[model samples]
Target: MAGKLGRTGRWAWGGLLVVPLAVVGFAVAKPVKVLPRLGPAPIFRLVDADGRAVTHEQMRGRPVLYSFFTTSADDRVGSVMTRHLLALQDRWSRGSPDAASPTPLLVTITLDPERDTPARLKAWAERVGVDPQRWLLLTGAGLAVKLVVGTGFGVYYETPPGNYDSRYVLVDAAGEIRAVYRGPQLDVATVAADLALLQREAAARGAARLAYAAAHWFACYPVR
Candidate 1:
């Protein structure tokens, strides 16, 4: 009986060692690098360019990218970001083999809704060659826009002075804000990588899912 107990102790120690070894291995090798879950994205309800009501609840179960831009004929940043996202199809699809749909939805919210009505947004969409099915340009009452943009997203948007910031937010399928990109220094590649990480996590299962959870718990983020 003593020998049996000693063998059991050894097995227990072996099991204990596996966890630390796994943590160390994850830290060193980083087989999975995940974007830190920032927080829950704010729930919002607004109107799409087609006068259709869209809500945060509606976007659940799908990864969503959100960008804010005031209605401006000269604001090339929005169009540039759109073009970059469109060009990143191959990059997003690199590892997502079983992703029911590899391409995540893009949502662009207009800051100047008072001037940019549904008709104007549709026209702007056409002007920029935006695919309405994939990308949604949204606008609503000025107050509602302010509530969602300023309070929810913490983005600054005001007219008259035309002072605003260029930014993009990456939200996971679970409606969690995983990553945020801002300023002129930010590029699409960084967002793409973080988003790929999110998508991979979404489609992961079994041991792979456990590995990703371990990666997250261990803070095994990729070196940037």
Candidate 2:
């Protein structure tokens, strides 16, 4: 009788072990969305619409949603991108006031600096109904702008011979490039979701920080 009881206990333990192993196998096989750590954000000097000097160093310790545009035309290139970005700002601000640190800044860097002077940027800001307190439009020397946008951000754009990639780059508070969105993938909900996730990860500490890092390592972004 004692031998039979011991045998039953061993079988029960073995079954429990199989359950955990199966779960681990299933998790390993499951598809997970992961954001690639593109690289460090480029540091550069630029002037905001308010004529304030904003530098890459100043942008550190806060998440920034950055987009490039030229007020040269109201085409899909510039106008469409601005509309989508503004929508993201609205949704994010309304979702939770605490969802972002540094108050969730939206930076619009002008590719056409010669035409996008501070005065021009101020005028454009007025036309677009931008709340300068939240949204910032920046312009600087041609070479500096080109280096920051093209070489630093990995965005392709050229002057005189016009070519541009309409995209948005999300930089985390730690100044790391986390994700890029463009085309049909650009949407307020998606941007907002990513922002919230990154903010939570940024604010985490101790074991929580470890968990967030693990999620990044495992590429745990949600499927769109």
Total backbone collisions for each predicted model: 0, 2
Give the backbone clash total of model 2.
2
Per-residue lDDT of model 1, residues 64-164, tens digit only: 88888755766666556666656554344454434564567788888788888999999877876667766788888888888888888888866531667
What are the per-residue Cα lDDT tens digits for candidate 2 across 1-224?
99999999999999999988865764565333345577998998999987889998877777788988787764457878878876766765565546445567788899889989999999988987787866789999999999999999888887832668878898887788988887423777777667767766767789777655656666666666
lDDT of candidates 1 onward, in order:
0.78, 0.78
Top candidate on TM-score is: 1
Clashes by residue pair, model 2 = 33-221, 34-219
Off by over 4 Å in 2: 1-34, 95-102
